[model samples]
Target: MTFVVGPVSVRTPASSANLGPGFDALGLALSLHDDLTAEVLESKGDERLEITVTGEGAEDVPRSGDHLVVRAMNATFDLLGERPAGLRLTCVNAIPHGRGLGSSAAAIVGGIVLARALVDGGADRLDDRAAFQLAVDLEGHPDNVAAAMFGGLTIAWIDGAAAEMQRLETTVETTVFVPPEAVSTERARGLLPETVPHRDAALNAGRAALLIAALTVAPEHLISATEDRIHQSYRAGAMPESYKLLRQLRVEGIPTIISGAGPTVLSFARGIAERAPQGWAVHELAVDVEGALVR
Candidate 1:
């Protein structure tokens, strides 16, 4: 795998994982995206990596090889047994950071797909399954990465030593309510209990299955399907506002769930118009059918 072209561009969509009962198993890609461009530097054998980021977390994100996108790209090159001379990377980000919108997953997928394009000299060589496994290997989880790689609604799980994903079709439109505050995925995960009652575990299993049915065939069961007993209430202290908003929305008969780790709420309300509470931003996003694209 070698590249005659100097630059390659890739775009990846934002994703929401752990939809209600699924908990590290389910995710969906949204219409929001981030664009990244990778170019091989002219200086030969320099081995330097330069990254320029604009929009979103530009002020705080790294501008070197330590950047998530650059790391992913490097991982791809390592896997392909090819070394480029140097790299210049530019990122145009639109997804909000720490909002449970899979910003990191998008960056990882974008970089990997960028490498796939560059390795083939601007031609695509990575297939869907290969991309899913590579992203999962880098991310250590399949939920967010699966949606970002395959698009639509994805159910991802570990099969022995390998990761597997299946995409499902959903007709419901999604609305995400993002609060101004950010919730760290690490902190939110730390709040979960090490063990739960057997009954609660059984209930979650049932709900997860029903959630899939609600998303695919029976739309009316969505409310009951979104019921969860595993992680949400346990992490209430970290996102009181999101928990309160979720309760209020459910009371009003809206099928809403905490997006990914929380601090962002996702509602499958289709065309319904509902008012957002004060101090929250609302975005109406469709399910992205296409995951990542190269140009």
Candidate 2:
């Protein structure tokens, strides 16, 4: 019998986390997506795993088990305590790697979804929450994973074995300004002081709370919502141009914030408007209501 297995496709949206003040707590999903295709084949004993990636960072990303997607699958299989059948994976990555686009989180979630579908009777056993847990555990963060899994603006907190998520309203059209440079999450985190002053911590807490409220209750508060007493200022040296551009946006009557850790910045505006820098390519995007899924 010929087992005609599919190149199962999974789509996960690009996300911007932390916003500015909501450190490790808030995230917003963008319209750009990472598309993955995985297929199961009766492989020869010699070829246990094979993967091919195309688009965006195809030239830069690994095409073997060392890839983050493959790592996510391996981690999932380990959790299930079963040696899964090998897979031939193909990824069409649209989101840029190390550009604050949550590309790694998307890859991790995409791999988990693909792995579940490829295994015998595994797809039926996997739930959204379960898949999300796997991605979060593998990615070591829940903000981006939650947005990739649940969609919209997501607020998540990790609690030992379980993760709690709250989906927020994404009412404005989001425009991203991606600088040419790529900033690693570790490097961004390293820029933060070991311990923020008590007053600064308190300020961030208040701003974070107000940001969440503004997302739900008052859209006008978004201007203030983008304020940060936590990460953005400290990492200004990494992407000084972004900081300068943000100030320019404020002067130009645009609401902008650092998308995630650094580098990529995002702005939310209504109507048909364009306030991006001349060299930047502005993609008119919206909130991706649907997260990672097979089609």
Candidate 3:
């Protein structure tokens, strides 16, 4: 297959996974986005893989094939049985890296979608399902990728090693309190115990189920639905300030959750922007329904 003659761009929204009780299974796409643009270049050798970055993570992220976006694009092209001779990719990132905001997932989704859109008949060959599977494989989890790919709110799971997901529309309003310092998802996850009490598991399961309704038809149930008996409190020490803020907000009857892995707190209510802690940034955003789209 031939590459598209001109540059192709993709707009991929940021995702917040886990969404309280659903730990690694539920995700929501936020209005915040990252845009990636790429075009086939005619250069050779080192010049063949030029990349430019701006906005978040630009100064710290790798510029070579080690870059997550570049790797995802290469994987997509490999899956399509074709490879571009060269590439020039530009990333204008808006999502904060390592902030529990699914920045990595957005990069993965954007790269895959951008690559597919770059090849003629790529969409027909690598359909959404195939692209999604590739994305899940690359991300090592389906929750964030699923929401970033399908948009809205997604419940994702693995079946026989295959990624599966259900996307539902949600008009949930959210306000994210992002601390000045970021927390590593790996560090946060490492703090969790290998096992939990059966009663706690049961509570989480029930709340996860209720979360679906809370995000959709029953917004009032969000407070109860977003409660968790696992993960959050376990990893609280690593992000004490974040957890404290979560408790403060929840005590006030707001449905607040530690976005993704932690350090960024997401509340399912608006008009509370002034509640953010000192040195924290706040953004009010609605659910993004389009996922990743070519522009």
* Maximum-TM-score candidate: 3
Least lDDT summed over 10 consecutive residues: which range in candidate 3?
41-50
Per-residue lDDT over 241-277 for candidate 1, one digit per residue giving the tens place of the 0 to 100 score = 8999888888989988999998898898855445577
Query: In candidate 1, which residue pairs get closer than 3 Å at backbone N, Cα or C atoms, i.e. clash?
Result: none
What value does the lDDT take at residue 183 in candidate 1? 95
Query: What residue pairs clash in candidate 3, if any at all?
Result: none
What's the lDDT of the predicted structure labeled candidate 2? 0.79
Candidate lDDT (C-alpha), each: 0.87, 0.79, 0.94
Winner on lDDT between 1 and 2 is: 1
Q: Relative to the unseen true structure, what is the Cα RMSD of model 3?
A: 1.2
Give per-residue CA lDDT, model 2, range 1-295, as digits (tens): 1223666788889998997788898988888998888776665664467777788888887777789988887777666566445677788888878888899889888888777766666755667778787788788899998998888889999887788788877666777888777888899888989888899888889888888877777778877777777788888898888888877776666667887776877777744235555666567688898888777
TM-scores for all candidates?
A: 0.94, 0.91, 0.98
- Sort order, lDDT high to low: 3, 1, 2
Off by over 4 Å in 3: 43-47
1 against 2, candidate with superior TM-score: 1
Give the Å error, residue 244, model 3. Answer: 0.4
Candidate 3, lDDT over the whole model:
0.94
Backbone clashes (count) for model 2: 0
* Residue 224 displacement in candidate 2 (angstroms): 1.0
Sort order, TM-score high to low? 3, 1, 2
